[model samples]
Target: MAMAADKPFTLLDRCPPSFEKTAQGVCKLHTRYDQYDSIQGVGVGGLTSSLPARRDGFTPEQIDLGRYLFFDPLLSVDSTHSCASCHQPDKGLSDGLARSVGVSGEEIPRSAPTLWNTAFLTSFFWDARAKTLEEQMLGPLYDAKEMGNNPVQLLASLNANQQYRSMFKQAYPAASDDITLDQIYTALTAFQTSLISLNSRYDQYAHGYHQALNQREIEGLNIFRSFVARCAECHQPPLFTNQQIAVIGTPEPEGMPLDIGAEKTYNAPKLKGGFKVPTLRNIEKTAPYMHSGRFDNLRDTVEFYTKGRGHAVPEGVEMNLHWHIWEPNLQDHELDLLVDFLKTLTDESFMPPVPKDVPSGLTPITHTVQTTTMINHSNSAPGKGE
Candidate 1:
């Protein structure tokens, strides 16, 4: 049954009523990073440094309102795609696509990134163009190939609905009667900040459960952090990303022209094909990896890194790759082991339930499970445990 509009949205993790708030309106979060006092070291395996501060602590009303907005197609120029259209609850909060296609069905030039641990990220988007989540939203909200909406039209759409007006008013009691763009951004950010994912088998091991991972997975973890592979150097533990720009020399899909990744954003020559390093927290759930979605699976993607550094770089293109990019000459078995360890990072513990029906009266959602073969962690078959 569809939930009543008046009822507050349900949540599985931290919230205002359960935790005390400071005078600044900030509520302290209980994260896995908080489990360890201060023993975590930067870039070290089996130990993680304190996570960057999160943007949590929104009221239940605001969060519930954001939840409704996130799934409502009313935000798009055409009443077809919602925020949930791209960032689905399934598929690890990422659409299962090589390149995202908007309501117009036009190619969006890059893959939809996973929103798993975005609350902890300082930078947003592949090019590291936006500093805040609100800024990040503007790109998709108005981009012709993305949501394709303008602020004027968006507010008009929200105001047209009586339920939305009431919801927004309740969410922001002291604000004006008129709905504003800032409120929309804040609501979205609030809901997204509540998307916490830190209870995986890997997290269990990180929290000091020796039997959580079998010997094979443990070996894989060792190889992952070892200098030989050095995957952990950029894909740091806890969040699994150093969150910096790097010209990794990833290739564009065949027949597609060069993207010039972060070069346009920074206007620098060295960053000709750089992009923000994404967290590998739910690597198995997101397929067709890289900024351009060049490789199809983990094996092909991992093998590309050791394939003579800039081997995948288009012919005649001179590039300055990140210093970490080097030939590791990893064995096939070792590569498989590394993949095994990555699967242990899967955790949908705090995944919010998709609404049955949104206030906009449009169909709530449609998503496809990724076709890529991967470990089914729920089955609890040995190393790939619950």
Candidate 2:
């Protein structure tokens, strides 16, 4: 039986944030959650969308156009990669590797996070660098390693296409200008914002559907809320995260250079190890997890949380910033339940299908990819086909 089946689950009932004590704050919270739930049916709420939605929403034509742009490798300088290359739909919108490869096939720092429910995030990037999803849209677009295309070339490619010109006419009838880089980013951002993931088992569980989670998952929930794991502290109600930044001391993997996670964006005072706390929603599919994409599976991730980072420490030990003092050891069954519980976060409905036709009249480019491949790790890889 589900643990909360017997009684009303007092999920949360604290004094709200001090700033939120007034009527205006309460109304603001309601409006945010209402919009958040309107797009994302997930049961939890907070400022998760990297920023508030722009007034401009996508039309059917714009969605089709954006879908094409997402998959077209021609946007890249060398025509070697697309957004789909690193953020594969099947892999929970992530590539399931530590660092992603560039258009030139060179490895770059950071992992690709799922676009699912990103509409709710108030800040974007693992470092929480970008303030809005619109701003975040342009990062990979011009990144040397990712899209690698300059705005001039990108705009030229779109302008040359008849379908894009027509789609732009339909999307922005007033604008005399046919196509620009801003329009392309706006379309892509709208589509990304529309990528809402909810209707997961966890949502059902939260909505009083007692059957959503099985016996193990129920036990896992208990432990997750208990002092032993205390995941609820940061990964709190609804969205499963507090939307705050913290420095969890995950070491830099061998052969990979130390990425001062938040320091690069926010400066040294924010702490050398700090990174944004990512939502655990649909976590099972988004593997090779963490900002650096270090761990391969949920078991490894759970172990990392329980054991804590082994070697590296945050700049100041006395600060004790985001360091978690987990239970020294976890039992086998306990770990099993935790993994099972996390699986409930999966929401297949949120996954977007590749568009059949691009608004730009571009054909979806196909690439030869190795199936079911795991990235080679120096710690785990065998020597000489051993």
**Candidate 1 Cα RMSD after full superposition onto the native fold (Å):** 7.8
Top candidate by TM-score:
1
Q: What is the per-residue lDDT of model 1 for residues 227-312, given as tens digits with 9 covering 90 to 100?
A: 88888888877788888888888877766777777787799988988889999988888887997578879888888777778887
Give candidate 2's root-mean-square deviation (CA, Å): 12.5
Q: Which candidate is the best by lDDT?
A: 1
Name the runs in model 2 displaced over 4 angstroms.
1-60, 308-320, 323-328, 359-386
Q: Report lDDT per candidate.
A: 0.76, 0.62
User: Each model's TM-score?
Assistant: 0.89, 0.78
Off by over 4 Å in 1: 1-27, 37-43, 366-386
Task: Tell me each candidate's RMSD, in Å, in order.
Answer: 7.8, 12.5
* Per-candidate clashes, comma-separated: 0, 10
